[model samples]
Target: MQKEELYKGMNPLEAAVSGAALEGAVASGLSDPFGSLDLLTIQVTPLAIGIRADGNNFVPIIPRSTTMPAQKDLIFTTAHDNQAEALIIVYEGEGKKVEENHLLGYFKITGIPLAPKGVPEIRVILDIDASSVLRVLAGVLMPGSHQPVNPVMGVRMPTVDDGHGWCAEALNRAYGSTLDLVTVHKKI
Candidate 1:
């Protein structure tokens, strides 16, 4: 019908975004997803996501409003001397402290070689795919070593869903900062 007129003076992408292509496809029993969604849509992060670090801080790996299908990593270290293990606690929100944000999930990184405080390198990675699924990965590496001592752990987020921050409060009261992590700041 009006298909010829819609394509008379427009490129495929322009026509698709102008709604003519989508309309024509529907009328002709065809399918086109981008026509309705448009070609310039960018999905941003809904909340700031990061891990708990020293002083119970929220060390952000992926800040809010970041595009989807993203992957980011950060370096952390032990808070105590001769620390053999550290807990990787993931949180999502804009709070500066871990307790102020919503607890997503947590995993304990064990088998850290006996070393002084801030001597080990603990790399934590966060990822969000096109489907909006979140995943976290962490591993331990000693100085001058490229390989991890233990197998990297990758887990989906929101392992704990107590929206009231009860989990964080309880965890802080019980384990405290004994298993906490400290951010490894990079020197400029």
Candidate 2:
């Protein structure tokens, strides 16, 4: 199935919360306080890589990989009397799974404030590399078609302004794209 099709009918926040709870259970070997493990079992219905956390615990799952370039959304909810935190790792470059595993970038969210003892969600999107894989798969699956050539570099830049002009500029040059800026000023 196509990667995009996986996450078409799911809520991002709900996905994140479920992902986090699953990972938390695996990583920490702890039971969920909310008694909602059933929801967490629903196959991650998104086409992206995600790591969810319940406090310090986490779990990693990717519905789509480099062969699939579908964006996915994830959510993680914290239990009462606790908070949530997470680290997401992305791997890029040419190599087998063993080799590529070492080359990765980490996105971390820390100290997510505690929600009232029910469920609060943290949402994120996962965009995979379907275009690249499509080319490769097409060539192999359908010979005489154009052979897929892996790009020299494949990376995604963050959309939010992280207060680094040079970094954004560099990213723009690399991707041949422009950034849209929205500035808000508050009067004291």
Clashes (backbone N, CA, C under 3 Å), per candidate, total 0, 15
Provide the TM-score for each candidate, comma-separated: 0.78, 0.29
Task: List runs of model 1 lying over 4 Å from the truth.
Answer: 1-40
lDDT per residue as tens, model 2, 1-188: 65644546778998889878676675565766777553433232233333323322223334433344454444433333443433333333232331222222434444444444333334444454533331100001112324222211223533333343343344335532111111112221
- Candidate 1 collision pairs: none
Estimate the overall C-alpha local distance difference test score of candidate 2.
Answer: 0.35
lDDT of each: 0.84, 0.35
